[model samples]
Target: MASLQNAKNESHIPAELLIARVMQIHACICKLESLKPSKQVNSLFTHLVKLCTPPSSIDIKTLPQEVQEMRESLIVLCGRAEGLLELEFATFFAKTPQPLNNLNLFPYYGNYVKLANLEYRILDENGVVQPKKVAFVGSGPMPLTSIVMAKNHLKSTHFDNFDIDEAANDVARQIVSSDIEFEKRMKFVTCDIMQVKEKLGEYDCIFLAALVGMSKEDKVKIIKHIRKYMKDGGVLLVRSAKGARAFLYPVVEKHDLLDFELLSVFHPTNEVINSVVLVRKPLF
Candidate 1:
């Protein structure tokens, strides 16, 4: 309760205390069969989000060995919670008569809207104007980013969404199937990004979702694979994390991006869960 109070107060939460609190919350999140809107769960998530916000400086390497041991598990737990929330909504929307119209009912729908706007602005600034074809790697069940971007920002661009899970792709397709415009613009492919060899070069821009690779090694491998197949001068937008958010998501460092020309890295000091890393494939 004290740790919860500390999170509410927005004080400098001790790393060990924060870790313990997260473990408790994770336990609660795991017990749920479906992520229905519960006041207790919502309050827990609210406190966790507050704790993860700005003003907390936590370096993963500097933590004690025991605490470090819990980091990966915590990340996995958080990712599972996120996936459950998405699947819950995706399943609901898939069953609905018109899912697209009810998209705003999603709790984190506003986050995707803001994120798409930010990514669109970044792409526009970096000379990716009116890209004809774009690809989104690891697009989950909801695929809200692709929908939001295609519907709002890049009205003319076609979005090819790649996800490893066939069920997720099915859910995504069902969610967007009712809209005629989305049916024309959004295409869901059920395959890993590594499997798409030749078609990768067709895209002018690619977005890598945050939960694509949960480990640094896996992330580097995916990045290298994309670099090998992606067209020259293609734009890559990676969703990353900074500050306390690293506790919930994997962090991508500059060194990990070896071949790409680093363009911009924007870390929001607000509630946005992901930081954006914009880079480009060199023409040479």
Candidate 2:
């Protein structure tokens, strides 16, 4: 019995070690709405790893001063070796979901996986209800989680969908059309998000998604363009690619966004950078 237990522990002593440990930590956190002191302090070393994977870093100067401050604090809180590993773990758990017996990732990627926003939960503190004009800015095989979330969470008027890759748009169109329930609510635009550039600032919500590692200039242009379209006080949500590089491409100068506040930082189980970073446009 003892030998078998040791063997099980030893099996996880490789590249997947940190991922396994983070899963343990996540399980622990799930039991408590807020982790106790022991959990928080001990979380630093739980996902110990043997080697580094992603061998790159970016100039921190581009981050917002506050994000920079938080980065420094996180680094100090977690020592060099462990900090990197924890980030690996964070990247892992934040992106990928725990796998099932029959399912592993589609491979060919690393760092973090992404969750479909369909699994996302929205909250309301005030009683006022408003339906929104929602925009989904990608076309891919990823299921319609964001649209589902939009339909349920936001009082949605219509779903405006676009994809740069026409084939990808076709895939989205098929999946949405087959859903039967969501068919009438969605309109797929097989073109650049900029096609309806004039409507940028008019949408009640916007969803950008999982295309990581694209050209830096393109990311900047997209963010700048979206800033003009996303409605004031509307939600700006992103589902970045899984296991992508450290920052969202080129870190398009801060405040280039019309956002006022961040709603949540939702990191899911690892796969792709399937994270949901929800922001609200400023009322200015």
Per TM-score, the best of the predicted structures is 1
Best by lDDT: 1
The list of candidate 2 runs beyond 4 A from truth reads 1-114, 117-119, 122-131, 141-143, 147-157, 240-260, 268-272
What's the lDDT for residue 211 in model 1? Answer: 86
Cα shift from native, residue 124, model 2 (Å): 5.1
Q: Which digits, one per residue and each the tens of the lDDT, describe model 2 over residues 1-93?
A: 112224324422442343344344334434544322354434432331111113223344564565544433332232333323323332333
User: For candidate 1, lDDT tens digit of each residue in 189-239?
Assistant: 999788889899999999999988888788899999999999999989999
- TM-score (C-alpha, index-matched) for candidate 1: 0.91
Error of 2 at 14 (Å): 11
